[model samples]
Target: MSKAVKCLILLAVIALFFVTELIPLAITAMGGAIACGLLGLIPAKQVFSGLSNSTVVLFAGMFVVGGAMFYTGLAQFIGNKVVSAVGTGENSLMFGLMTVGTVLSAFLSNTGTAACLLPVCLGICASAKIPASRQLMPLAFACGWGGIITMVGTPPNIIAAGALSNVGLPSFGF
Candidate 1:
């Protein structure tokens, strides 16, 4: 088969597996990438190169930290405090989560804030008997919005400020 057609067929199979979920998502994803390498669609060496990127490393570190929080019971403690303060209702919990996420992301890297908070949110959702999906998506959005609030919260803000200063314009502070 032509490379393009073969690649498309592979993509279709992967998409089907993802939608049907017959196999675990991560396994299916990895399998698809490996298949691409075996099929000569991409260099075998490059198939896993994305995993070594800085962003991936940062995420891996954050996940480890989050896991540590859960293992240490910190997530449960924080979840308890949040549950008591916010109450168990879905709307209140969501509002509280988004507010906290926004405040944190305004002062910290959005990705870092989200990664650190993910386990806590999961714990909170579990204790509240709510699906993590309902709150997690909104929390992610809040973090992104918060990153726009401060120059140091995200790289784009710093880059934009630097560009302005290089052009002899006043740059934003804080």
Candidate 2:
């Protein structure tokens, strides 16, 4: 079969597996990648090339930092301060949470920012008697917006910068 046809079939299978969720998404993705390499659709080296990408390294480092913050109760301390500063009104609380999420995500991965702030957001919601549903979506949207504010804020931005450099175009600067 042509490589393109093989790739299409592989993508279809991966999509089916993802929708069914019979196996972990990570496993399904990895398995599909390996199958492509084994089928000669992609180079073996290329298949794992992203493992060592700088963006991946950055993500790993940020995950560790976020985990440390959670373990040291720093996240909770910050959460408390933010909640107290904003008071119990739902609009004020939502605005504060989104602003924090956006600011943190501008310097760190959105996933890391969300992870670090999730418990704090939950605590604030519970303590203030605000339903989590009202604030979490805003927090998520703010994180996404934050990613566009800096070159290193998200993997897609980093990847796009790399692609530009590969094509002999100047990369974006912070």
Candidate 3:
């Protein structure tokens, strides 16, 4: 068959997979790569190469470092001191949430930072008789926005930093 025909077939198969929803996303991803290999769409080696990409390694390393910080109770200690000084009003809570998100994202994934603080924000909402869904979004959004200010703040930033490093630009120094 022609390359165009094979491409169309692959596209149809992917669309069908989505429509049918029979396979888990992980399985679908792997199976898609395998299918491409079997169909000779690209070399199998190319498909697996991304698994060892430098960016992936950097991400895993940062997460482990962040986990160590959490495991040592350093994060909790700092949070306690800051919260004590700042008070637990809505603005304080918002700033706390945003700062936590920013600092944590500097050493962890932004999504991970958000997931970590979500419970705390919810607790504040419960105790203060406020709606959690409202306050937490701004806090989370601010963290997400603030993450752009540093290299290690988010995976995309890390990747950008790495790309800059490749071209001799100074890194954001984490």
Candidate 4:
């Protein structure tokens, strides 16, 4: 088969695996990368290079820390404190969550900030007798809005800066 057609077939299989989740997502993803290398779609050495990226490490670390916070009940504790401080009204809850999410996302990865705060928001929602669905969308929107505030706030921002520098333009600061 032509390489392009083979690559497309491989991609389709990966997408199917991702959607169906018959295998663990990480394993499926890694398997897909290895398959591409074995199929001669890409140089083998480049297949794992993405794992060494700083952004990947940052995200992995954040997820580990977030999981630790949830396991230790720190997220619950913080949620209780926020609920007490802000009161349980829907507007109040949204304001508190969005403010926190925006600030956190402005300084950290938006995805990481959202992941870390999800448990805290869930805790807050549960105690307030509110549906988690009500608050979750606002939290995501807050993170999206905040992610544009700084150069390092999201992967897209970093990529944009890199693109600019690659084209001989000045990169964004901070």
Which candidate gets the maximum lDDT versus the true structure? 2
Candidate 1 per-residue lDDT over residues 1-174, each given as its tens digit = 899999999999999999999999999999998999999999999999878754456446545654676579765676677788899899999988888888767766778778777888987888789999999999999889988998756667766776788799998877
lDDT of 4 by residue, 1-174 (tens): 999999999999999999999999999999999999999999999999888876577667656765776689866776777788899999999988998889778877788788889978987888789999999999999988887898656888877776788799988868
**Candidate 4, which ten residues in sequence have the lowest lDDT sum?**
58-67
Candidate 4 stretches greater than 4 Å from native: 130-134, 165-168
What TM-score does model 3 achieve against the real structure?
0.75
**Model 2 agreement with the true structure over 69-173: per-residue lDDT tens digits:** 789987788788787888889999999999889988897888778767877898899989999988888998998899789987788888898899889999996
Could you tell me the lDDT of residue 113 within candidate 2?
Answer: 86
Where does candidate 3 have its weakest 10-residue lDDT segment?
74-83
What is each predicted model's overall lDDT from 0 to 1? 0.82, 0.86, 0.73, 0.85
Estimate the TM-score for candidate 1: 0.56
lDDT of 2: 0.86
Clashing pairs in 4: none
lDDT of 3 by residue, 30-87 (tens): 7777878788888978877776878888778867876776688766675566567667
Query: Which residue segments of model 1 deviate by more than 4 Å?
Result: 1-78
Q: To one decimal, what is the Cα RMSD in angstroms of model 1 from the true structure?
A: 7.1
Pairs in clash, predicted candidate 3: none
